[model samples]
Target: MKKKLSLLVLSLILLLSTSSSIFASPSGFTESELDTIFEKAGTPQELINQMDYYTKLFIVENSGEDFEFSSNSTSLYKFDSTLDTFIEVKETDIQPLGYIPSTDMSLSMYTFNVTVNGVAMKEIYSQFEWLNKPKDFPAGIGKDNLGIALPGGYEIQSGRYACAVQTKLEKNDAWGAASSSRCTNQSPVVNNLYGAVWEFSASQNYLNIYYKGTVKLTARTVSSNPVKRAVSRYSQARENALGNYGVSIGIGAASISYTPKSGSNDTMDADTNW
Candidate 1:
């Protein structure tokens, strides 16, 4: 009986040693298999811990600073070439708009203060809302309030709510509009919203979490306002793709003008199987 029991124990050991190869999946497996399978591997706590570690690694590698993740909610950031550095700016900072994360947020002066390899950096972003001129205005009297302010004597006549995202160097107050999106070393995947409204921006290294999300302005536009009426609804199919932007950082950028409030749904690449 003792000899038989020893043989059975040896057989169990052999199975345990070979389990990895036995269960190993071949190449070309679908992505869904990864999100589901690995998540099923360990207990809830173990998964959380693994996720937390990976999140930190990703942040540090890209931003060159330590990244802090939260259990509840947090604001995400991106690097601005115009700003020359990265910053996490909350719209609530300048205005008392009520959508700040529960925790108190602070602005960083790194863009103003730091330089890499002799090149200066810009950090903070200055947001602007689109204010198109009313087409119905009297022939002589134009609709654009910013006619004198903007270039070429052209008013904000693009009733399509053209929200031009602008930023200033923390070193100085010279602000420039993001005339063209150029962060990831590639052409912008989608044509910026041709219609009046747009929000958020993305790069190859870091993509806006909101798939359909556009470059956000500091303020919101009134959909009911006569001057800023939408001609057509937002319709861009490529916005739903994940392959376009390799990695992602979710910015829960929101505006009171468009609500129920929205946030980014980020899929971290920490899962090796994916």
Candidate 2:
């Protein structure tokens, strides 16, 4: 009877996985890999043995919150614990926003509060996640974009961002994230990519939300007039007195969409896809 109930619940989750929403966890891997995973058959104990084997193969943890295990690794299998059988998280996770300055490639700490219906919510992260990053990063490149060569004078380049959520809690509750269909701005300014997302829960009179994170990209822009500038003669004279060069800030054009972590903004869904 318990096995039957587990199967029923697992089926429901699998079905819901297809629905367009932030909760869907996609299986991360190639089609062939997925087929290989689907070919496995088993009970919960067998699935755990398989998962343990694959986890060892990848040299990664067998189970970790915020870390979705949808893809197969031969050692790890995606199973419906309720059903005691294999299942898949079609899409899971979220993308976060913000940029890292090129000067110091360090991860910035960003914190925001969540109020659903009207009350604030709390969460926790893992210590290993925080400790794994570098203390100080490269001079001009962030961890995300590091080792990727770029042309000179190219101060900014756009790319997708996938961040890990670091929470310190017994339950290991965290913001699962994915990139929105819409492109957002991000900077590889830190040693390792880390960001947050919000998840949601509701009651008769209350709605609770948590932050999940994923990777997406912001568009790149070029200067319209890179070498030409107009500055005031008087300003130039003042600069000469201070032994400074003429200064004129040139603005470029680009577009970026970001998600706010609190209030009504915390509620995100498939429509939020870019």
Candidate 3:
């Protein structure tokens, strides 16, 4: 009886060890299998991120009175292949706008101070509603109804930094006339009612806006007024994508406008997967 029990124990131990060794082996993905995956993973969006890094940089040219980017929310991320995460590289809600480009030459400067309508200037918020939100804006907003005043003593680039503004349009009856002419042909990918605007300016600096095509502004207010507007760049992108993989940052550069409101979207790259 004792000998039979010993044999049973040894057989069980051997069976467990063999099972573990089978899983521990590299059969699932040998060097050859990994090569196949690398060869098969050829997609356009992946190519763009590899080639250009596709990161768009926009400095907060105007810091009007309103919401500010929360400390935990402001971040820069780079996609990590091994971990499949957008690793945060730099983050700061308090970082002031820097690398402000001159309106005349679009030349980026390193240091400067900016004010709006005599106010010393705070952070840029896309709209007043974001300040009232329970969570505040998950994403930082843009500033409007203000002029960027660069105190002459400081250089332009020192105070500049890049940020992304998410925008949404409330296509109510009021936008009827302008929407037809400006947005009728918008790509189905963009909400058409929303777009992102990236601008750069310094204290008393000039800004020139160029529309890809000639845009006839029926009313100056129609283009400049910040009404029925909200910033939700990622939100709109997600919505437009439906349930598909959706867009991640570094996909491509989004084309934008400068009139404070109502911009069109353009494809930065042909590859949607990016």
Candidate 4:
């Protein structure tokens, strides 16, 4: 009986040890498997070239006072020629391939700043409603104002407001939008003015490669009475005719835009390879 008990305990210990060894690495892949991926990639640069990533930005009104932007998530994918579709690469798998995670590389360090008519405005960070909900937005379509909630009490005056995102990377590298949307409405009614007007610019880097592409969304308000009417007419006419606005951000096949009503479901990719 004593021998049988000892053998059972030894078997349990061995099983636990095996399980730990199998899952010890952050990635579930074993060292041998990672080596195989590296071998298949051919070169380190090619391994990076095989991967593509994108970030999502959602701009929504906060408690009818100010706008809130959420960029808490990013998705990475690797092109599989055989599958003919991009397969998602887990966050844990990024470092194993000798590349920094997208979140760490850009998203985590992003800084958001607001501006009114070219003058910087203050940004207040607090617990927002959308933060609790899922961050999913449609990839490339437009929707109505059903879920949108804009601020109120500014119907008398029109202004151009913007919320821009920026990130400082290694080796004095910085990337962000040059400008944002120039059209916005102060009334609580969702306006037909929906679009993204920003250019993402990046400085050249010789030492290390960083993400050179960017996607940004911002809110704007036009205050002058005459300009407001003109904007309203232009926006309505465009919305009624085209139904959507497509703005190209001229970076490695990346383009982003908004819709006629909701302006929430837009996404773009920033390729890491040169």
Tens-digit per-residue lDDT, 165-188, candidate 3:
222233121111111122223211
Tens digits of per-residue lDDT for model 1, 30-138: 3333334334432234433432222222222222332121111123233334874334445454422332221322111101112334433211111222122111211
The number of residue pairs in model 2 that clash at the backbone is 47
lDDT of each structure? 0.24, 0.22, 0.22, 0.27
* Top model number, lDDT: 4
Per-residue lDDT over 84-141 for candidate 2, one digit per residue giving the tens place of the 0 to 100 score: 4323223332222222221212111111122323433211111011112222211101
Rank by lDDT (best first): 4, 1, 2, 3
- 1 versus 4: better TM-score goes to: 4
What TM-score number comes out for model 1? 0.19
Better of 1 and 3 by TM-score: 1
Candidate 1: give the clashing pairs.
83-122, 84-122, 133-156, 160-196, 161-196, 199-214, 199-215, 200-214, 200-215, 200-216
Clashing pairs in 4: 158-222, 158-223, 159-221, 159-222, 159-223, 160-221, 161-221
- Overall local distance difference test of candidate 3: 0.22
lDDT of 1 at 194: 22
In model 2, which runs have C-alpha deviations exceeding 4 angstroms?
A: 1-27, 30-152, 158-171, 177-208, 212-274
If both were scored by lDDT, which would come out higher, candidate 1 or candidate 3? 1
